[model samples]
Target: MGTIVVTGGTGTLGRHVTERLREAGREVRVVSRHSAPYAVDLRDGRGLDAALAGAGTVVHCATTPSGGDERAARRLIDAAGRAGVAHLVYISIVGVDRVPFGYYRTKLAVEGLVERSGLGWTILRTTQFHDLVLRVLQGAARLPLLLPVPAGVPDQPVEVREVAAHLAELALGEPAGRVPDMGGPEVRTLEDLAEAYLRASGRRRRVVRVPLVGASYRAFRAGGHLARDRAVGTGTFEDHLRRHFAPGARG
Candidate 1:
């Protein structure tokens, strides 16, 4: 098989995806701003074509919350199209179309670009990752006493490794447009997740619910980001917490 280029290969999701592909004995070229030899910034086309040259599949995982995902996708698509890449697999959030958040909107727009890129493509929409939920709670726990979390919002946090394995499988196969959604084993309220986080970290902070205002918040509260029927992931958030806080885990 030809080389598979993975963007953002140094990042959390991309790292696992790259590892999975390599374990499968595939030729994997990791392209990122920090990845040497094949370093390329998705924000612009600089060095992107060189990284994508002779690649059979390109897994677009690089993303930012500070905006500009659309531009990045455009550059990547242009480069992939020119390089004669066969399949373009993209990772996206489950509620991109329903959520009004800027990042989600950008992701949805990127999905549209991938669909129209004139190359075979696959899109996998997944729920929030366990690491993200834990990170948010960790940040909130920085408060002296009470840990405030969004009221009425629930999250289904999937394991990143599981997602990476699936993405690798998709990359090794033919393009399948818009596959089924993937979700965590269980869906719990934000407050419940915060409390669980506190318990897992041995913190004594009281979990407080703060009602957020906005269409995006409303969509989240209404479970627009959840995939109750698609609870395909086997790992729970607690499982992630255990591994995260295990001995030598932080290192």
Candidate 2:
């Protein structure tokens, strides 16, 4: 097989993916807008012609949070075809099709594109990441005195490294095409997550659970982004908090 190319190599998940691939002694090529040997503007499709050349498998971890998930997927798909890349692996959130959000809609569109890209493709619909959860908690902590959390909004926040390892393993194998979703070991509510953050960090703030009402929150409350049966990740929210908030933890 040729080199394994990793898109979005600068992002949290992509970094771990590249690390795992290199540890396995695989010839890895990293494609990113910056901070990688193979710099490629995935949106404009620039540099991809050279970045994907001789690539056996291309892991699609790149994302445009603001918008343009579909544009990037189309660009990469065309590039992969021209480069003769074999497999295309994508990282997606669970329940993208079931959720009624713009981002989820865009992701579902990309999933469709990958399915019909005529290449061996695998899309792993994992739950939210611990990093994102932490960021939300941190933002909530900025409240004057109370951290407001949406009640009944549950999440299965898996660690990035776990997802990255899974992606690397999938990249080495034949395309499985919409394999089982990956999720954290346990399901938790947003309130529980906020409480954990406060407990771990010893923050002097109250966690207020507010009732959720919007469509997005309704989907989250209904477990739209959960894979209850496929809790493949071992790490838990408490475990992640310990790393940063344990006694003598990082300052």
**Residue pairs in candidate 2 whose N, alpha carbon or C atoms collide under 3 angstroms:** none
Runs in model 1 deviating more than 4 A are none
Which window of 10 residues has the lowest lDDT sum in candidate 1?
242-251
**lDDT of candidate 1 over 1-251, digit per residue (tens):** 68999998999999999999999999999999989998887887799988998999999999999988899999999999999999999999999999898889989999999999999999999999999999999999999999999998989999999999999999999999999999999999999899888888899998899998999999999999999999999999889999998888972
What's the lDDT for all of these models? 0.93, 0.89
RMSD of each: 0.8, 1.6
Span of ten consecutive residues with least summed lDDT in model 2: 242-251
Instruction: Please list the residue runs of candidate 2 whose C-alpha ends up more than 4 Å from where it truly belongs after superposition.
Output: 246-251
lDDT of 2: 0.89
Per-residue C-alpha lDDT of model 2 across residues 1-251, encoded as one tens digit per residue: 89999998878899899999999999988888885567878788878888988998999999987987798899999999998999999999899988897899899999999999999899999988988999889998998899998887888889888999999999999989998999999898888889889888788788898896778878878888899999999999888888867677654
Assess every candidate by TM-score. 0.98, 0.95
Number of the top TM-score candidate: 1
Q: Give me the overall lDDT of model 1.
A: 0.93
